[model samples]
Target: MSQRSIKITMSAVLLAAATLASTAPAGAAHGGEPLTDVRVATHFDLAAGQMPENITLLPDGTAAVTFAAGRQVALVSPGGGTRILATLPAPADGGVHTPVLGFPLTTGIARTPDGTVYVLYATGTADLTGLWRLRPGQDPQRIAALPADGLPNGLALDAHGRTLYITDSVLGTVWTVPTTGGTPTAWSTASELAPTGFLGANGAKVRGGALWVTNLDRGTLLRIPIRSGNRAGAPQVKASGMAGIDDFAFTGRGNEVLAALNAPNTVVRIRPDGTSTTVLDAADGLQNPTSVALRGKDVYVLSAAYTTAADPNLLRAHLRGHR
Candidate 1:
């Protein structure tokens, strides 16, 4: 073993390392996709400093985003730009934002056909959280508010917009409230329809008469019927094995759904039957992405909290509209 031999061995080891890196899937650490594109879809980056709690798409190619810690709402462009909307009130102010909501939580957001915006807030207090509605010009309103002793999160509308379905993470179930804003009827009042354990049921959206849910820890996608009792059926696992998924969106009538994998920061497309493929990877697709929304070909993702002990500034990415 002389100098020449040592040098040759070192070179060989370096080459092997590079080869392995090239072949490995992106987001392998958290189980997600690889980086590929550079389409900073939004105009402003919300990736680093702000913790995006949730995002909902608007028809005009924009999206409403909620920052959990900042307690602010943002109107995000189809590409990657962001505009801050109104902040929400605390439960002390009568709106949902109490014990029931998860910690540092933005919870969820939804929009009505008439352009009414509703954002769900959790106060970390089990009994004080519910829903907050914001109109175009007036102060925000609270619709379908729960009793001071209840919890609510993950909001969704039925196929016809008649009912709003919500998932309570702590309660481990989904509930429905009428559109006119009255007492909420338990959509799946029975525990049999709700999942349990590492199933991690959260982030629900109704599409095509079915409910789509993101399983927080187990890394899965779940589907359940909106109607309960005789009309309600047991929940099923629609898709599974995702990477820290948070939110997802489906094309108007297409079978494709783009799911957000938050931890590794990526997006993946899954078919109606549960097969999936990587559409966006972490290194390139996003950084700490929390939620996703789609209108036509455009896909919107919110990048939350990329800053570290070395960096404190915020960051974000906006992918252009896709068909």
Candidate 2:
């Protein structure tokens, strides 16, 4: 990336962070009841110099995390132990540098039932932008190439696991590729997906027979019906008014979801009826929560804590009262 582009990108991200800091409430409490039994599972200080961004839990009770600054994929054992699973090649310039904080690169990850892992990264270089997959004992393989301007940030897989959906934050476009390997096609590109600045669609998922995505800049959650022949129906807003929405996960209820509000460091629960409530916030000690994952009755959150990467964390909280 050129110096001019880097300046523009950094300014946008800084502005978003500043906006959240200025407007968000300082305390931990929100209107709704807070989530229960919140605990820290892992802290980045142990993985020194690494900034953990996104996570995908493996079937064997371990989590695969993408270290945006460390440039690697690591497995976090249930006991809080972490080890590098695969080291991705360093991207050009290794992403932009910001004082005190870490780079804003390499953010999303997903795993197939068969143990295959998919990662999204942007190096501001043509050949290094898009999704890559790592099979057991195999090297990282580029599955598809996104546009040069694409900033791929979140990933999701369909029910049959035949298709993979990726969200591009910079371009506000969603691309789909066959899980087993095929041409990546533009799945959706409506006006609703347009980027307001640097963030457009940040996180995506397939649940309850439809494709759901979050617009980080718009503060809206959009639902698009998955029609016959793998096509997308007209998009509709499911929920909005969120701040710095990054990634989200379903709560296993009808249409309820948990979202990470990065700027203010909060997690919110959104219902199918479009109502939202804070489930966790700064009072809960959350700092730049980037993504949320659920396993059984427990919810896991990964925080980037952009203010300083020294203590970014992985937190666990009990799932409660979602019907």
- What are the per-model C-alpha RMSD values against the true structure? 11.2, 4.0
Q: Which of the numbered candidates is closest to the native, going by highest TM-score?
A: 2
The residue-by-residue lDDT of candidate 1 on 15-90, one tens digit each, is 3322333443443242343222445554333332245657776777677877765566778664546677777655
TM-score of each: 0.73, 0.88
Clashing pairs in 2: 28-283
Question: Could you tell me the TM-score of candidate 1?
Answer: 0.73
| C-alpha local distance difference test of each model | 0.58, 0.75
> What's the distance in Å from true for residue 310, model 2?
4.5
In the range 182-226, model 2's lDDT, one tens digit per residue, is 667998888788777657787888987778988877778999888
Scored by lDDT, the top model is 2
Give the lowest summed-lDDT range of ten residues in model 1.
306-315
**Number of residue pairs clashing in candidate 2, backbone atoms closer than 3 angstroms, sequence gap of 3 or more or interchain:** 1
